[model samples]
Target: MSAQAQMRAGQGASAQAEGKAASKANPIVSALHQMAVSVLSEQLREMFEKADDILFDSAEKARASDEQRLYLDTMRIVRVQRNKIVQAFQEALQAALAGIGEDEAENAAGRLDDMSQWSLEDGDVLEERIAVNNMQAKASSLYAHELVELQRRIARLAEMTGAGLSPESMSPQRIIHAFQNSMRDLPVDFPIKLVIYKLFDRVVVGRLSEVFVGANQLLAVHGIEPSLDAPTPARPESRRAPRGLPQDSGVPSWAGKLDRATMGAFGAPATGGAGMSAMGAGAVPGGLAARQAGHLAPVGGAGTYTDSMLAQDVAQILGSYEHGRRPQAPAWLPPENVALVARMFDAYYRDPRLPDNLKPVLARLQLPMLKAAVADPRFFHDPNHAARRTLNDLFEMLLQFGSAEAAPSPQMVGELQGLIDAMVQAFNLDPATLRESARPEGVDERTAEAFLREQEEMQQKKNRARVERVRRIVAHEIRRRIGERPLPSGVLRLMLSGFGPLLCLDYIRSGVNGASWTETMRLVDRVLDSLRPDAGRHAEERAAEEAELVAAISRRLAAIGFSEERLKEVLSGLLQAYLELVEAGAGRTGAPAADTVDEAATAAAPLPPEKELQGLLSILLVPGSWFTLWEPVAQTKHWVRVKGYYPVQNTVMFGHYMEERFLQLRATALATALVDGSAAPIDPSPELQSAIARIGELSFERVVDPVVWTTVEGRPGQ
Candidate 1:
């Protein structure tokens, strides 16, 4: 076998072993396994039902085969579920990590701790239960609106046709058409058009007006007309009987065939429809047509609707038309195209690597996809349609957002909304004309497969290009920082090994988001300090650098308008902290203690500079820290203390803060120059002042959290 195949096989074997060992230990894994088994059992039962006619001669025979089928199905399901659970858990964990910021040391640590404690039997179960409840609540809200609309529309239709429906004509196609006609006033690209179309599926609609009820005196109290309970005519002759004729023996002939006609309308026979007796359409209680119609109708009799129901139905239908439940394929869009795009999103949504929250957002794209297809045939006809490419870009953005812990930023949300809005507007311009325009120009089924393959290859190429660009950017920045100093061979080797690729990917991201120069420099200083040889000369040089940093920072602050006294105070405090940090590192600070020469020797042993540097750099250069370029490591002393600054959570916010400060410093220096008559007077832009005011208005707490400098239990070497 090839090396890749062998590696995969080994991994599979190892994972299986691990899962077996942890099955009893991890309640979460156990629950997932159990859920998988349950799903498989239901699937097996379905398979058996499908094969009943061919595989079993009788009920007894079917029962006899159950054990064998169950055993086989269970074996297969266990394997599938194992793979699924491992992949899904890994993906969820990674996505969770993506949201944490470099300076969010506490949060990252807490997240890991919580993850470690997760048990499907307890913590996750509670969350899942909560999620389920929220989903139900949303569904309920949607249902209420739908129920009202259905009642209103049905009532209007009933009034128009004297409260009766023609069963044979209420085919799925016609019902969909009726709904479409009713919503003619709505915008062509409205999302509810898709929801209404989806509900047209026969399984969901299920005999729209079907009803059932008892034949006895119960009908009297319910005010259900006896003739309304008439069943579907089992014989053609009964159907052909005069409309006024009494089909049921219990009905008086004088009451006329309208009762039999009513029975036919309800799709119920006089003897009752199957298991039901004289239950009229109104008596059917509730059906899928009711429950699933949460967006359209309530659980009510199919025969009649009240004014309240009509009002509700009208309200919901209008509400959906105005504010869609989700994005959908636009009207006049092709089903083939809709299905193709839907399949793509479904694949992404179902992928184990993606977070679950993303599914709803991804699913909304169906409508937009359909709208795109209809608006420009090239979206469906060409392999490299610009619209399709844009969609692919959006998909990547969505994945990135999903991977993070924090909610997507307002800017991203606005961008997505604007994109969708533009598409809908373009689509609405001439929906009628574009209805059939895309199909004839589109690729045929045979070519479609090839087109999709080519597109997939292009997508892969794009991803590779992106990674390479980011990698180059990171390497450039790191090299620039190192300047004339030759990077140690060991450090270079570490960079070239696995570290470079990952770090570059992260650094590029930070750069794109606009990492501040101060943050970048701090990271460089930390890495260099950790790795630098601990010679006596280097220690003396570090002390000089510390004094230099204090002076430089104080100068910068003073230039930005800090009073001399404040600058001196800040400088004095920082210098004292640096001294303590250096002394602690040399084991010359802290409480006085009696120690032998051996103890001193041990403390002063030749520092394994390379090893210590590697350990420190490895800890701080983790991927999560790349975005913010700051992370806290557990240590006894601040080995590389420069300034008491913490990284912000986002590059935009960081850039904003830095820019505002720079502007202030620039104005200060310019004013000083002007007073000396060495420079021209400067006038501040009104916009700049407004921006500064807005920045000032923002709470410091919202932009960044302070990192606490604390002495921990152990240092890296210790």
Candidate 2:
């Protein structure tokens, strides 16, 4: 038998032995083993029953002879070796479960050794492993909530039973690993294996929720945290403390001062006044507003008339505006506080930057926000206050719909409207409702921040797939073009490692048949040809040809924002390879020492100022940074927020601010945009901050317009 075959057989034998030993040594492992056998046996039986039919259908529909043959062979192997495969899989699972809490470093070292072997003899094995990892990542994301709950329940069960079981034993990574290990000895090709893995993912991993439910039930029967509820998603940690406050303050700098001001403003007793009925204060029992009137009643008040009266008046006035009536602030209420909220909404309504469709949705929040501001002074003082954060999150979510040139989908508009309606209905005197509305616990459907996060995750997934596709295309193209062409090893390495990404970017931006792609391919061929022997050519002719080729290469690299220093290094390497080829043609050994070649290739080169600037901008333009991009042809500016950068594609993804469009710019394109004044970064402060600043610019005495007071008091504006 071959050495590789013998090694794999020994590994399989060792795993089976470990599984048997663990079953004998640990009672917990025995229990888990029993459960896994019963559950997985039934699941695998169902899976295999359908697998043959699936393969037959695929073979019938196959477009190529090779594809049809592959399916037929896979089906035949599965039919013949069904029982053995199942037993092997069960054993692998048992071993994996038993090996929980084992040294991770040991497993990592084992994997490294396996990879080294695969590199030397079987690259298909490495590719299969990569495919499994990608499948596992996708499954983990799709069932994230279920997996988290399962981990929690398993941890609790372990704690109660005095078992050393780890939550990771049931992770997608481990589950996929066991299946891959079982199939390692099968005589199936990579494509067939991938198809089977997909089926396994669908049948086993997709139904992991059922397994989790059963495990939770088992734990509950043992009285381990009985009646376990769905786990709450943990809130992301705050990146920074409330703006303008000390990190360790625990309270805003204006908290105490605001408290004193609030008390003084609402401390006065009720005196029956002419505007009381207009403000809805007369609707209260005994014509005296209580602090606990309803959800809209301001909290933390001493039942004073001014406190509840002010909130009720704001709600009544804003409610009138909904019915096409101009809102008039109550004449007896504190003008400064009323004017602050009024001007804030007015600014929001008038702001041309906000899309027209979103204005009505935002307008619904005026009364809720006013009540929150009255009840909690932190709403104004702390930028990170829940209410302010919630508002900002909503605005950001709406803004991701591209620029005004592209319209948002009706479905997205409906979702936004629904969220606004829900928030308006739930909000009261407390701002916690705003936070809750943004990130609801125990809810099936995500609304504000959670919904946005899911969308961003999906976008990132698509971007990653695009990058992978582009890389595969680039690799195939390079191999096809370099078929059997003997070139210097250093030059080949430079083409693969250094210039490959630039080709990928060109393909991503302008597809396979584009002029840019053709030019890049031609340049690659020229570089390869420059290192070949030209027996009939004069020395000067060869030198001139090499010089022009180097210049062309430099220009191509420089256009992609490569630093001059890096460009010089690359050109020098190519020239050295050319000289070596010439020496070899003269019957002299020409290969440089390995160390010398390594230094020339691997040494870091300093970036030129422009390239350094590009790197700096790439780092700073993280997700959520806003920029205005100028369209020269349209003579218009587009507002976009950075979604992310994909290094493999050399692309930056930007989501438009007013519509549902996304734009991806290559690194060179982005750097050009910045340098040519076509793209400029902008500070998009939170909606509340801009309003507060606008209000600050107004004179304190005339904060409320004289005309508004006159109209509310039943007089002409004059």
Candidate 3:
């Protein structure tokens, strides 16, 4: 037969196969997707029903699980889940459509392009939450004014719709034309639906292009599959000493490609060993119970490689002496814990990205590994042994942390600290250990340095751990309080965890909301009422932690931010404002009407700063376009002590606070509205003067504003 005739027969067969495959697969995928989405939407509808029941019912039974008690919690969880399912639906629909014929997919794409007319997620879900809490007209107005214009742009393309044209005639921007015609009443501001629709449009457009590409290429014209080519796996290197190279006595027996699985992860033979056992297949090592529990006997390759598997395997082989109870461990014995420490050390040594502060901890590994090598009398001359030993030392530090707020373990953080202090001293004594440890043949210098840095980082972490523990306690307390839960532990620890000392200093120096010393004491008293509300109920272990926290905070405050000098200055300024304002209102003896209080004087010290506040709070919750004033000192301190000192909780609380404060100030300021709306003669009392002076003083840093020196200084927004 002729070649052209043979090709025709082959093409006919291929077309028949493609047609049959499409008929089988297309409807199946579409049905699966439809079913999944239907189920998900039904689940969502049920959730909404549950919420409606909660909201409308006068009395409802509480759930036995005590979960999702908050209204916000229920709404948030439901909404987020709905969004996840929505995204999944979108992905599935697009994927299934990709399996359809090219023309059919494009037709579907045209329908989805009309999504610009669909209402997606609404911003009211977030914005309305802000509006409801803002009772003061000032905050409400500010929020209303500082808003995004929800406008929609409908593109109407000019297509040739002249005589003799088809009835389906539409412009090049046909999608936009359809959207405009579909709108009931378009918004004046940026359109949220349009933005989301545009994203979907891009995906469809890409798909359409791919469909065309396929039609123009192999899909339109039959193409042959190319033969496959791939590199063969290389054989494992032969196990033989290098010619003329001296063998190190300590080169461990299972060193090269040692059993991948220790404890059965690598599938090592189950021997009933500590870290080494591969699950025992038969009996020689151990019975069924142990192997099934994953206590594996050490054997050759069983699974994926774990770098530290051998170290643990070796340590188990050495046997557990229970803290050196053996009169004298074998002359060749290494500390069992050293294996863990060595693994940690090796990782740190190999990692160069470690910061400088952590080098001390990284340098700590040399001696432990070298000591092990010396005892074993192997790898005496091998550099790799030295490198591996270095890592062992570094791993010691990595294991320093895992759990939170637990009592310090002796072998992990405690013993290591002492050993580290001693080891560095020895290094200082005889620099020769560097060479002695470096004698292991296979290691690199950079790895050694990385190990050193890792160690230093671990030490820094330990030092910082004290403060972090306290912060954790505080965050837990706040989260618990907001959830209306019982206090978990002493409140003091919760306060001291992260930059805990620094925050305490801020609290001491600047009493909350510019309260007077007397007022501050009163607030503290009220605060202390809850600080130990669950007193005498703490676990013995937790009680010790709380006491430790209180003492630590007290002691650490002296060292924080120049011994509280910053605190006293800010506090003195704040207290004077408080007392002066009190006197201005009611002679400090009589009951001052809330109206008599100079609203500005009542202004809380700008904390967490104005810029941060503006960035955090929505306009709907504030009095003016401006939200919070960023105090220069506070901003600086925030950056220095913590990368972003404004905690999310602080921002939330301060957002609520700013709204209230803005309303108070604006109430009096707005009085000018009665007459020509000119500036009101709001008297600046001494207290107000003090507060303003303090604010300006903080902003200026006891120096003139740099802008004052510039030609454009007086102009706004420069």
Using lDDT as the measure, the top candidate is 2
Which 10-residue window of candidate 1 scores lowest in summed lDDT?
Answer: 655-664
| Candidate 2 residue lDDT tens string, 334-431 | 22333344434433332223455554456445556655555554454454455555555455454444222345446435545555654555455443
**Deviation (Å) of 33 in candidate 1:** 23
Give each model's whole-structure lDDT.
Answer: 0.33, 0.52, 0.29
Lowest lDDT block of 10, candidate 2: 255-264
> TM-score-based ranking, best first?
2, 1, 3
Candidate 2 or 1, higher TM-score: 2
* Model 2: residues with Cα > 4 Å off, grouped in runs: 1-29, 100-121, 226-718
Residue-level error in angstroms, candidate 2, position 64: 2.0
| TM-score, candidate number 3 | 0.21
lDDT of 2: 0.52
Highest TM-score scorer:
2
Clashes per candidate, residues 3 or more apart or on different chains: 32, 6, 69
